[model samples]
Target: MTRILPLLLLILTALAAAQTVEQEQQPIPAEPEIAEASAEEVLDIPPGDISPLAGVDLTAPGDITVMDHPDDSGDRLIVSFSPGSEAEYADLFAAYIIYRRPAGGSDEEWTNVGVMPVGEGTQFVDGYDPDFPVNIGESYEYRVSALYLDETEVMGEPVIAQEVASGQWFHQGKVRVLVACLIFLGLIFYFFSRARMGATMYLRPIAGIEAIDEAIGRATEMGKPILYVPGLSDISDVATIASLTILGRVARKVAEYQTSLIVPNRDPIVYTVAEEAVKQAYLEAGRPDSYDPNSVFFLTQSQFAFVAGVNGIMMREKPATNFYLGMFWAESLILAETGSLSGAIQIAGTDAVTQLPFFITTCDYTLIGEELYAASAYLSREPMQMGSIKGLDSCKAILMVFITAGALMSIMDLLAGTQTLSWLKNIVTTQIVD
Candidate 1:
């Protein structure tokens, strides 16, 4: 059974929905037990009652009434409260009315129905205001709450209301969508950490990185400068980070071979970062003085300008080896073609999906989407960094499963038309998609 946990988790996730919070569709805060909370306690719902809001509250007392109006026939709803009852719950500042959108919809959006002004009489009438136009036939669900509003440790669910005429059934859908999100995020972080710990992982070899040593050695033999173009993004981009990491390794190799290096960047911040990476690489290789600060310089931020400047570098300096690493856009093919024209051995790494095809056709090597992000771990062998790669792989696997399942189920559902085997083929599609 433990071995089947992942599959079970998927099924549960498919069936799960989230509890609705006010206004925003955040997870309903875990409701405290009426007396004292127990780990296994759940919010209990009474027959014909509604939740104070829509959705399930696994951590809630589970038994609040949520209101729904199937038809606007009864334009007004009132909860009569006696003076004695109001005196008994002295801490209750006001009564609140909560409403949800249509069925099969998320309850994250909140429109306050009505409120009992502080010190107003105990009775409150919802949908009574003349200012808002009366909505006919449109269904509305409401939950009534008596709250302190400002106090932190507010206690108790007051009462709930629903439209008995064509009422929306609350129990039809996933109860804990918010909870599902938490579980999903937890899985992501867990696998990410596992990968970083050097957990045994096998990823397909990236051709671009595999050819780095050969490219650098060829540059060394030619006794010409080596060209390094960090992608066009700022240092914040993960692709840029990967490119810089590869540059660090490349810098060390250049230092050892006493080959000249030129790195042209499109951003000042990335330029600063790349310079530091090269200096560190040189310092690490016991040739601190060999690293040239002038070699790593900032070019304009324009994509074509950067591409043109790099093309000029290849033509003028004629670097024997050219590396285009980081995030790129339309200029990818232009850069690769220029490098090819320069007769320089070109090795490129980037995570841009759109630009990948151009690199594949032109450059000797290229790193695909996340693989460009994986170069640091591939070359650095650092534990935490390697774990990040593993996390990415795990995330990819999860997405693959989700996509494949969604596609197959959709096909099955199309053939079945929700008549036979509806449950097996149903997916949580949004109203937009439907």
Candidate 2:
């Protein structure tokens, strides 16, 4: 055992001696080398201002001029300038800032009023300040400067407006409107003259107007009441006024036939007006005693409550004919539907565009748009009323002619690529500016 242990120790010693010889045979790595720098090779740069727009030099704006804005109500001034050599300095041009201040005011008081794009002929309106609105007959100074892309601005010389802004007695832009009005007045005078000579003014027949008597006759034949809603609007509404006119006529017919009439009103003022109208009609028909005071009364002021009251009346009284004429809103459908359910003949007329569809759907006959306005004229047929309608018809015909001609001219200009008719287009499209 001692001999074996001596052999193992000899083997371990031999292995250690071999590993030390292998380590001595391997080569060691050397440190990296760097080249030495000369004193002249290192640079010490001083901090200096460098412009962002270093390559392009922008010139100041020139030929600054100011004038009163035309056709305005003495509230605006037009500032114009010439950005010199636009093509040469176009690279760095951003916009032109317009500066304005009261005359003789310090430079520090200058306010940037407006801006204009960089163009050869640049102009800016200087009177859009609502906080400090331009005063009439007040002197003001303005300057224009070129703003560069790098936030640099070069100022130009100042210019004063030659004339202060002032309002004109007659706007030149609305000359066409004035001419059209004059022509309409002349036409009205002509029609009135013809009507005074007992000439019959022909009008197109409206089915709604033609059906009014039929509705009244139906109620009379059935021996039932006629329900008339003068509308939810007050007496001030034109639709309500027209409804009252038609109401007077209807009441006269009902009085003549001795048929019961029921007029429900939403507005108290309209109820009063309707009551008087109905009474006058009965008097004219020689049946003033038959005009029931309780017939025409204010139902309610609340919108939906009025609808509910009218619905209750329709269900209980079971009217034979229903006439709904005036400015109606969302309640139109509910009223018409209730009358329809009661097997009543319904004639509805209104100027409210949103409620027209409901009336047209549920009512027997409906007066659409201007037909309601013309109902009184259609029924009365008085000389002055007929003449007025005729005059308005003539004006409408003239407008249609102008509109048709303008549309054709626009199409021709579009196809031909020529603006020879632009002058006519402008005249036709010119509107009155307040």
Q: Which candidate gets the maximum lDDT versus the true structure? A: 2
Please give the clash total of every predicted structure, in order.
Answer: 26, 0
Give per-residue CA lDDT, model 1, range 1-434, as digits (tens). Answer: 85699799987776663322224656989988788532122234454454333342212111333333323454544444333232444553344333334433455744455566557754555556775323544444443444432321222333333332233344334444545456666765776677656587565676777788788889888889999998899988988887888899989988988889999989999999989999998999999988788989999988898888899888889999888888888998999999899898888777788888899899877777767778777877666666666666665676677667777777776887755444433433432121
Segments of candidate 2 deviating more than 4 angstroms: 1-64, 80-99, 106-130, 143-158, 221-225, 230-237, 257-276, 286-318, 328-335, 351-355, 403-434
Off by over 4 Å in 1: 1-200, 419-434
Question: What TM-score does model 1 achieve against the real structure?
Answer: 0.55
Worst 10-residue lDDT window for candidate 1 reads 53-62
lDDT of 1: 0.68
Question: lDDT value for candidate 2?
Answer: 0.86
Per residue, candidate 2 scores C-alpha lDDT tens digits across 1-434 of 86899799999999999989888555667767887542223222223544445665557887877788888888888777777534566765667888888888898989888777765358777678786578899988888888765567888888766667776677777777789899999999999999999998789999989998998899889999999999899988999999999999989989999999999999999988999999999999998899899999988999999999999999999999999999999999999999999999999999999999999999999999888888898999899788988998999998888788888988988999878667777666766565
